[model samples]
Target: MTDASSSLSSLIWADWPAPDHVKACVSTRIGGFSPAPYDSFNMGDHVGDSPANVVKNRARFLHLCRLKRVGQWLTQVHGTQVVEAKDDGKVREGDAVYSHEANLPCVVMTADCLPVLFTDEQGSVVAAAHAGWRGLASGVLEKTVATMGVAPSSVLAWMGPAIGRHQFEVGGEVRREFVEHHPATDQAFQPDYQSRGKYYADLYELARIRLGLIGVHQVFGGGFCTWKDERFYSFRREGTTGRMASMIWIKK
Candidate 1:
């Protein structure tokens, strides 16, 4: 468990040039009420963490972030579906959530999968996407940018923590899926010398390639390895573990 005194300090704020009205943060695995394995700050209720503990942790998160509304958490299916975040209190089924509304946080929970936060230069819209290998390969980021209803050039993106390149080993099929979409993606995978048919995948590079293709050139905040950094959760490292959240919102 993490120290209560360090709870507020544990959040990793996005270091980007987003507009003044745009607020974003990614929670670390510190400061909460869960026990070992899910120990301390586990934001995902869908994981094995106690629902009550997840609730308390989320409450502490909102309190620390000074957010007025509950986050719009999706039942992420590793697909390319993008939905608008509303105050309807419905748990939508999608890999991404975008919102132009104030105080309505668009959030994505991730352990090792990439969590991407988006916002327009005008700060009128903000979004969060859960980009696992499946979703990333299938165009979740593209769908998110398209849903923002703004020119892709006007959007700024931030790649949150995830499994880093060296730590993310993948099978031949995973590499083939990406290379099949864009042959250039082949460069993002390097063969694992010791393990035949296995390769190390760079999710960050793949995300940058996707965002660049969609005209979002002002991307920032990559290089965090969830597997190596214990501050965040990593399903790849611990099969049964908690999840962290990356949240973005427009200020009221």
Candidate 2:
């Protein structure tokens, strides 16, 4: 890990309040080794990017900061499953990962889905979650917060790039899932007058409401709309697009 500041251009660092020991970043779609639809900095290997290119890009991503440990990458299922971070060099099957250990980054990959990074006021632990619409409706953020082994009130959350509400049209069923789980989320969805039985969904609002339900409320970082922003990879906007990596870890 040498001179990371120069590499900052390829990533969007989490803008949140946590101890200086916590390190987090979301890799953008600019500045990497992949080509075509996964051009340049595509951090997701599962999205049809060349395996070798993914390896090179990940190495570059890790060098963005001096974390000597491997990121706990996951085979995200878009569900509420949470995995404890382990640095065995194995990718696990879960939508979220958390760790109390320093240097061991908890990582999640996303395209249009919301990537969330979490930490406590004391920076005792950190976590990351891949929250697509399905995972959000199923309480993935709550699970990540609970798994961090800290008081919910002290948990701070930062949402990474995601599809904005205006570009995220949802059907009646999708809206029903969230509103049914948390009545407060109804306001997060606005009826699309142009399309009957359709509504514009806000992923950021829904996540904030869910975290609030569990007493975790120091939320931050939600102005990025991946679909419209070429800096990020959006699955909804481009069917064969790449994915971005959002990671968080204690850096003692």
Candidate 3:
């Protein structure tokens, strides 16, 4: 396996750097053996892609990394449920997984939805969460940070690639859900000009507000647009699409 510093041209896992003993990476839809819909580097098994091809892609991902296989994969129901990572077990069902153990990677898969990575100041614990609009509105980020057992102020969050605000148009009912939940949430959505009863939502800003409300001030990496970027897989752009992984772990 190539060391993180030695392989910077992977196209996918290049943006995130290994800093302060916490290793992290967000894979793009490049470099693998799947075909057509899955194309390459498709990590999701339930997306109707060929199992063997998915396995090959996963193996290739592992082969490129110095770390061992990731510990806990989640079913990702887009709910706020958070699970503790187990040393020995299959992936569990949930939107978030947290662990203090080193070398046990916590991973979240996404196409257009957000996959967020978290760690505390000392790097003892790390987590990953799948936050769709539903999950975001329902407090997935808050719950995931709380599961780490660190003060929210000491944690650092990294927002991975997601559907950009320009592409995330939603109806008034969706806006109503947030406003009803928190009257202040009205600021997150702006009226869409092309369609009535529809508004463009800024998910990143919404997440920032949610994280800030809970005191997690050290946040980073919210620039990529999965829907507009051809290099990354986007579910909104291609209804039947493969998934990319966002992973974080403390080094042993």
Candidate 4:
């Protein structure tokens, strides 16, 4: 496998100790052809960016990553469904995707929501998940772990950029959803002093709790706050903005 550092100066590589065959990286809003608002490397076609520009940006991403296969992009509905990544070039409707096959990149687009990548220690499989508050509460990570067909203890996860705890304000419903499922998640939410019926949530902590529940203790990356970081796209920061992608694959 090629050294990721050579091709990925503008992106964030997952900092886990994944095997050499397991490749993963998260795209930034830099180095592409799109114009303002979506300004440059916008990877999500479903967003309002020009289709031609989106295509070009995707091409640039593939070339920069030195990936020979097409990314399996999903039509994420913020649900817990996890599907196997296939190279059919068709967009599947799900929040997470896993693949044991080499060269098929499992990818998820996100702006403010969390993008998570997963791999087993043996480098035999990789998966990606889009975890918004709804998806997180609905068990997306748990579903992804189960889909990988590996023991939870063997899985390593990396959390990508997202709206951070101090910036991500949530309603009572959001807090209730998590607390009802796992009371320990209550600590992940802090009361929003400015808003009465709202709280600031720690998405990274929530993800760690979920992964820990399934015995996945090796987690990394999560210091990113898309809203504050200009390098990443953020929906909450820009209402009509583009999306960045978190992708993973096994080198063929």
Candidate 5:
């Protein structure tokens, strides 16, 4: 039995460049009721954690955030599918979700994969995206930014913790997907010696490139590495693991 009230002290929330009207946060794996790999703050339901503990953990975390309804969804096999948060509880398969309506908290879960949050200058809209390599390459950020119905120039983004470049070993095919998207992706890939057909890839840089292409230059955050930081949940670091959430919303 974990204490939900006292557990709020352990999650990590990003302090991005967005204005006060937009409320955004990313949870770490420190505050919840589970044991071992899913010890605490594991918000993912399909990751093999006990369903009851996952439920308790999510309820406890949601309560701690003081939110009644949070929009979370079924993330499909890495691709860029952006949907509306109004589709919450419907189990839509998508990599991103956004809403112009107030009080609809959009969220994405992650371990080593990147969770990116977005909002505009007016703070009338907010979005969250699950950007694993394929999603990033397939334009997940671009898709999310387009859902805002605002000028892309007015958008701001915050890249949450993810697998760092040094630890993200990718095969030639993975690198091909990015380079095929943009030849400039070469800059974000480096040779990996541990295997003959692998390279170190930087997810943040790849996202920045895609975001910049869509005119989102006011981006912030993106310096943390889930695989390297003990405070975060890293699927790559630990084979069977927990997931943390990155969320964003407009206070209604």
Candidate 6:
């Protein structure tokens, strides 16, 4: 059990050159109603956190963040599915979210996996995606930009905290899969010196290369290491852990 009150001041705000009406932020594991394992700040309701605690945490989150409406939360499955955001209180099943409506935030929750927030230069669109290695290899980011309904060149994406390169060791199969999809992914991976068939993959670099290939070159954020930094959650570091949330919306 820990202090129940928390503030958004410690949150990770997306630093980008997006239009004024566009707002984006990423949550860190800081303070909340949860106890122990889930600790104080856990945004993922599907992670065995108490429903009541989740409700209190999310409600307090909105109040503190001053969001007039609720964010669209999805049942992320590490897939490339992108869905238009809706705040109707129904849990949407997808790994990515997009929205054009004001105050309706597109949210994605993740632990270790990458969470990406997107918006257009004109602030007419916003989207978020949960990109793990599998999601990356399967084109979640590509589909996210496509679902935003904006030209890839106009999309400005910000990658939030994730498992960083140094700690994200992957098997050769993962490397080969990404390289097979795009040769540029090769540059994002470095062979593990101690392991014969493993590599330390740079998710940020991979994402940037993937986004660049689609004409979305102004990618930002992402030097964060969830496993190394105790401020964020990491499923790889802790088998039973909470998830941080990445969100974006157009302000009216």
- Span of ten consecutive residues with least summed lDDT in model 6: 1-10
Candidate number that wins on TM-score, 1 or 3: 1
State in Å the error of residue 202, model 6. Answer: 0.6
Error of 1 at 70 (Å): 0.9
> Which run of 10 residues does model 3 get worst, by summed lDDT?
1-10
Model 6 TM: 0.96
Per-residue alpha-carbon lDDT of model 1 for 1-252, expressed as tens digits? 567624668799999999998999999888888998898899988988899999898888888888878869889899999988878778899999999899999999999999999999999999999999999999999999999999999999999999999999999999999998788888899999999999999999999998888789999999699999989899999999999989999988
* lDDT: the better of candidates 1 and 4: 1
lDDT of 2 by residue, 171-249 (tens): 9999999887688999899999999999999999999999999998899999999999998888888899888899998
Best by TM-score: 1
Predicted candidate 5 versus true structure: per-residue lDDT over 15-127, tens digit per residue:
77787878888887876787887877788888898989888877777777778885555565678888888734676788888888776688788998888899989898888
lDDT of 4 at 223: 96
Query: How many clashes show up per model?
Result: 0, 0, 0, 0, 0, 0
Per-residue lDDT of candidate 6, residues 143-234 (tens digit): 99998888998989999999999999999999999998799889999999898999999999999999999999989999899999998999
Candidates' lDDT values, in order? 0.91, 0.89, 0.83, 0.90, 0.83, 0.87
State which candidate, 2 or 5, has the greater lDDT: 2
lDDT string, candidate 3, 1-252, tens digits: 222313434435424433568978887777777788877778899999999987777666655666675578778898999998876748799999998887888888999898889988878889999999999989999999988999998888888999999999999988888888777778889999879889999888888888988999888888989999987899999999899988887776
Give the total clashing residue pairs for model 4: 0
Worst 10 residues of 2 by lDDT: 1-10
TM-score for each candidate, following the candidate numbering: 0.97, 0.96, 0.93, 0.96, 0.93, 0.96
- Candidate 6 off by > 4 Å: 1-6
Name the best candidate (by lDDT): 1
